[model samples]
Target: MNGRSPRWTVGGPDLDLADPHFYTDPRHHGIWRAARDAHPVAWTESARTGGFWSVTTHAEGSAVLRNPQVFVSGLGMRLGADPRGVEAAAGRMLVVSDGAAHRRLRSAHQSWFNGRAVAALLPVLRRQVDARLGELLARGGPFDAVAELAEWMPTWVLFEMMDIPGPDRDELAGIMARAFDDADESAAGAAGRTAAHTEIFAYFAGLLDDRRDCPGRDIVSSLATAEAHGRPFTDDEVLLNCDGLMNGGLETTPHAVSGALLALARRPDAWRLLKQDPGLLDTAVEEVLRWTSPALHAMRTAAEDTTLGGARIRRGDRVVVWLPSCNHDERVFPDPDAFEIGRRPNPHLGFGGGPHYCVGSTLARAEVRCLLEALLRHVKSIEVTGDAPRRPSNFLRGLQRLEVELVPEAGNGRGAGADGEEDVHVHEAHEHVRATGDAAGDAA
Candidate 1:
């Protein structure tokens, strides 16, 4: 306990962390700074929904996340999630389940994200990223990096891994965008979210059925054939988990990539530093994840009475761990606001901790690292031509659109991975990603 009383009262709009606008507005950074300084663990009251304990500091947020038995995720993991919907998916979904159920479910899909498994996908990932960078540079004008590059890379990798049919990929991607859309916490917004989920489930349900009779070498097939408690996963379990995996895979890395470009654009010196010393790609990617902290907050319900930061928490009280705040905690990372590429021992909770740590973290790191490598090998500089619009969602924080001019490296006719320099960095970066298993953040 910090011995300081929790900020029990919500005094103004700035303190209303539940509002999506708070995330989009630049002032939110200062707001989190103030909140963390005044009340590391504050009691927030929302009239529209309900009240929750906002865990803002790194120490307390990590403590809550690390102790899942006391703070269970089965009730809900996000602020605006519908209570009834959460109840229905409680034990079935991987993100919401706790205890033994969560372990078994995670084990079923763990093989896909292991270091060797993700390492196998590096060549394909590198090629795709390189090709995309080449195409964008050839156009020779300002382009929407979000629509063209940031969103494209992860979506492609996810679809390829899932083996979704070519024609169906576009439709599924659109539905997924809506499923995690930055909608408000209102009745209408809830309906829209539910509809998107229904569509995703229906699509995955068909895929699950197809995988049952003729299993393929993909995640869906593995889940369809996987056995837990000596029994196969039921249709509901498979469908719900598929929804969780897709949401996690698609929603996070794009924002990290977008945020990376935005961060570099704002600080050209960082980009120049990376170009000069490509070996820094490993730490640079970690810095991007820490700086972005795309998965803004994760919620958990108290399973038993507990005292957190000197505040009495009832069994049913909801506690939300603000990831960005934790990542930005001055106590943990010195000069936390500065995007220092060479930061060492960065213990950012961009990814939720404990049993619910992000399963796709390795793949996410690979994707970001590949993009940066492509940029270093081909693009000379990143210039932000227009205002980068941010996604308006309290749960997810990222740029919705980034208009940037990608200047091609001089005398480099070919796209990414064209020259020998790429090979050297790729080898080094690949070894780094495979070796550093502790890297964490975003999407759990």
Candidate 2:
């Protein structure tokens, strides 16, 4: 409402989202390569949200997060949106909060995701992943792995962790998806989000009360009765944490699960290799997280003036640490674009860095590993029927829908991933800029 219009920018200043070249065209790799090289920290003026400094390098990204005081997360992660959306989402408890409150809130849930803590929840994780795989097999042939693995898989896992009980798990999953879509810039989007938040919050509020009276072996119970600052968590805090867990855990894992399937589908050799040595699952999981690079960017506004990548960032200026882009930075990764299962010393920024690295990173690793083991154990091969569609957001990155042929492990090698596509293993596809100002568009 304030600006002239959503001023579109690109290597070609005339471009906008409506350009079919971006939508129909798949290889925007050139654009990303350009942004990284020509201007590691590129800026584009606003038609709407003014401008944002995109940090496409690894070292700069690390700096953005290492000093939270300088690159604050609470200013709102998705570059610029309505102030009302940010305020409406106040009390939300994920990585967005800063300082003492953030440190304290993070500690409260520390036990829930600690190595020992997550390992304890493994048995349940195994059962759920296995059951889901069987359902995938019986359902047969063509199936939306995104629906099964990405969406339902993590939902069930998080549900069990939160002690969500029976059918409400599905409700919570729907609500969480709605929460992301609720970020849409429309009254309807806001209304849907409000209702979804109210329902899930109310549901958790009641459970928190019940847990307070009769504690159980669930995370909600842990938080409801938790007392760190000489008091119980405020009602809003409790609900935000629950919703945050559901949203963060749910969207992230599914992206990896489904993205891995897509990645492996593209490389049958990798899929076949996985079949022969399931021991490689652990490495495979890390590589999957790196290759897919879900949860695209995390925001941090400068708390004070600082220098990053030779740019003077003044206090209050907004800077975004691009996660997936860093994963593909040629300087850090020999071949940043290619998905290498054997990527040694593969310290990708997929989970982020510094004190703000995904608190649930370990849990996410275990959850994804569990799902992979189950899928690899039963399913022999996977094939995609058409081009995979990515979600439309600059923040969260994952598939919207992925059609997959769940060929049985016994699949007589029929209909395998095409010729050159036979999953060869020569790693390293690094990125470079084309010396023009092209943007990879916001992939959330």
Candidate 3:
């Protein structure tokens, strides 16, 4: 309120929520903090995406997410110029759909993605973690954690759940890494985006054809044979929904894991506490989720005129809720900036809330827990080798590369990754950016 202090007035130069640069830069927090104190719900205009409301506080954002009837998700969860074809096509996916259609599609695989299912897969997931760690340890030096370790769990688990063949895992993961990138500001990024989507659709379509008659217990089989409203899913429905799962499965977990590792490397006290008391892993996981809040924001369209945080939201207006800001909301989180490992009652919006809450949250949490457990068991200390490169996207707070050197625990024997072979196979870092700067927005 002070005229002397710098104000981030909405619709001015300080308010460009859709810009990728806003996310990449660190100064946005001061602006958001100011927004929370002054304008809880602020309006802004973008030349690229037109005009929309920016909801900065936790209470208003949560209310928006909860009251889906008012703040809808059907128009595609991004704030930019309307890509009619893409929005129309993406609407069939659960994240972009609303009401009965969203519920129906979500219910098809709801049981499989629940807490119980994730708990049951713990042993298998542990083995997967151990195997990946073994490979990482085989190489006797520093490695990019984003490429070598953090990125391993999600896609592998997704392929396993979907019963994708071992041979196809790497290729499919590559396609997925390419498909969701909307941060590339280059001309080639645009062409690659289309090509990547085409390949992904064709791959899933072929899998659907193969599994149509001889349906197995895989997710593809379940979807291939699922019937909603007494009718089977059309081919387009199946493909897009499959792609939706792939998109969800591909991005969030890695971001969390990499971010968690970065947090650990920085905060030695929390890292030591976890090492000394592994029982604190769950609490540590929650703190990590809160700190990372990887998926930055979710865009909702107003279905009806409503008043929120003392501002009138007109029907059909876009409401972009910043999750990172909500996670750092001072009202809910005391000392919101510190990375305290054992913070309790930490109900962070990292996974979001309401009907459109992340369906794969259970799996994501399990993966992070497993990753932390593996780190605590195997590594004594981890140090950052270089600056972490972030993916150039506004939506996903993802790391492109994270270089870390692991110090193995004393008395722990080395695994196959200890082999000092001249040539070792490691998954290199991937850079995916969409040319148009849409950032591949999601409901989560």
Pick the winner on TM-score between candidates 1 and 2. 1
lDDT of 3 by residue, 1-444 (tens): 212112237446756677776677777777788789988887766665777788888999899989989998888786542366447655477888888888778776575576655655666677667667766665658899998788888877788678788799999888888877878756797678778988999999999999997986667877788886677887888898888888888888899999999999988888999988998988999999999999888999899988888787788878889898998899999999899888988988888789889988877888999889888877888899998877777788878899998877776534323233211111100001112112322233
> Model 2 — TM-score against the truth?
0.84
Ranking by lDDT: 1, 3, 2
Task: Estimate candidate 2's alpha-carbon lDDT, on a 0 to 1 scale.
Answer: 0.69
Compute the lDDT of residue 331 as modeled in candidate 3: 96
Residues 1-444, candidate 2: write the lDDT tens digits: 223222223457744322212422345556656667776665545444556566778878878877776777777766544566566554356566777777667767776666655665565566666666666676677777788667876776577667677767667677778877623655786678778777878888888888889986567876777875676787678877887787778878788888888999999888778878887887888899988788777777778877777666667777877777787889988977777776777878888876667878877898778877776767777789866887765556778789888766674332221233211210000011111112221111
What Cα-based lDDT does every candidate model obtain? 0.83, 0.69, 0.78
TM-score of every model? 0.91, 0.84, 0.89
lDDT winner, 1 or 3: 1
TM-score of 1: 0.91
lDDT by residue for model 1 over 1-444, one digit each (tens)? 323246544337445677777677887788778878788887787665578889889999999999998999999999978788899988888898998888778777676777776876788678768877877888789999998988888888778667788799889999999888855666787778789999999999899999999986677887898887788898999899889888888899999999999999899999899989988999998999999999999999999989998788888889999999899999999999899998998888987788788988888889889989888889888999999978988889898899999888898745753444544444454444334422332334
Better of 2 and 3 by TM-score: 3
